[model samples]
Target: MKNEYTDHAWDERDPSPWLALYLDQSTPLPDEVKAAWLRDCSSSSRQFFLPLVRPMARVSMILIQLLKIFLPKRWSHSMLLHRLLALSMNRFVSPEANWLIMRHFHLGSQVLAFVAANAPVAVTATPLTPMVIDDVKDELFLRHDLNLFNFVIRLNKALRTENKELLPVPEPDFSMLRQPDLRLEDMPRGKLNLLDLQSAIEIYTPVYQLLLTDNDFWRASNSLQLDETVAIYCAKILASPEHLVLLNNKHPLVPMTTLYAAYRLVLHGLSSEMLHSLLMRMARGEIPVPARELAKMHKAAEAVAAEESLAP
Candidate 1:
């Protein structure tokens, strides 16, 4: 479905080539061509997931604490599987962690059967765009907070293990709270403009569904799509630092990804807003960032930017 050849990091100002390689292409992906694709996806999954385990697991712990505010231990434990799953997928944690999650969910016994039945066998076939996102989006939306929290946790895992080369030092700036030209909530639907939150979900929601249904092999298949989304998200948030501070539990995915993305953007002076609107749409829950963290991030970005500008 997406191109596998292009290399676009999160800070790259122009993510078109990166997006084209993964999102716009329709070239056939038979097994041979798909092999490389799968490898890249594996690499991406590893990159994104490794850094997030501890953070998300901790977040899960805090959530359990918060859940205690309104619910009892039994109910919280009952939904624990969903929580772990949400974090595992959203945070992009390692496959092994997903395995551990399955064990935690008590899905260990069924995992093999699920993988065997769902994973594609070795045979020649045309690999169209994966449908993982479509199959699971509604389920994810229903458990919106868990999903959003999971994304943040997964990001932590990725950051923990990312290569030094992939980490970019961001420019310092006090911009996370800066007002945008237009609020997404205020956008009009009938006008001919870029897609708003609803439209973005309509267009991108299916990707995660596809991811859910994909057998490990197929999971391996759509690796590029995962990376593209991450890179695109990272670049967009850095250019619009204010988006990060504005996140809260109410707008979970948007703010969490934006927050993680801003961190990513800081690693490099490169940045873009191409995906900001799309991210805003994905915000199905709230995300309240601490004011102190917000201030620190701005200072970090501004400092990094100034350093880069002066670099020989």
Candidate 2:
């Protein structure tokens, strides 16, 4: 009923300011990280977007054709306005199959909204177009990518199911902190003996589980140590295309990205909240390091490998 919340929708024509503020938090976001992320978004754009994007691009023209062919002569060309509004709203937030439905509704809403705004009261007794109107709404609803929507919806539901209180991180597992000899140079000198491998596993299980199921999760993987096997797997997944799917999964990319950001943060001895916003940014497509982070890690691994190879 009330249109007040519409401004907050992703379809807002000017999301730049919001996006900028959003990215600022993720800032100190390294250039290598930034470049890596842009590359990933670009690749995703090509793979998942371009195919169906064009049809929506020409939705207005298609709407004209539909109205001409299907509508009654007396109804003004504006009858399809409602569909346009609905579509635009849907497309802004939805992903996957439901996108088609949103596209159609956007074109149709323009006509319907126009009619609703301008149509005058009419006393004419001719039967009203009941079936046609219902069909339009029904079709839009049917075309919705319900599965994808449901998944996202369920994810948000799950997150909100609990309070906003932060989950307590367990003690670090000291026994598993043994850093391999090769990392002695590149990595800062630290007590490898202090890390709580088991605790880290418990804290990071959600992320590791997602990586296990993702096919591309290992593409960017770089093994660091036996104890960090899960972290390496996670790095692989984040660098892989599977990141996109996982981002859209039940836990959503928000938490996953946040976890990775936190892992990096922990290494820096930074506060966990340092990554809280960054995780939100990544979920909204501001992933830092992205593939490049994986590349860096890979390079580090290679450097270690090379050193090991030349060992006397």
Which window of ten consecutive residues has the lowest lDDT sum in model 1? 122-131
Lowest-sum lDDT 10-residue window in model 2: 218-227
Candidate 2 global TM-score: 0.20
Clashes of each: 64, 34
List CA RMSD, all candidates.
21.6, 27.3
lDDT of 2 by residue, 191-279 (tens): 22122212222222233223222221221111111112222222332443332221211222222322232233222211111222233
lDDT of each: 0.31, 0.30
TM-score of each: 0.20, 0.20
Question: What is candidate 1's TM-score against the reference?
Answer: 0.20
Best-fitting candidate, scored by lDDT? 1
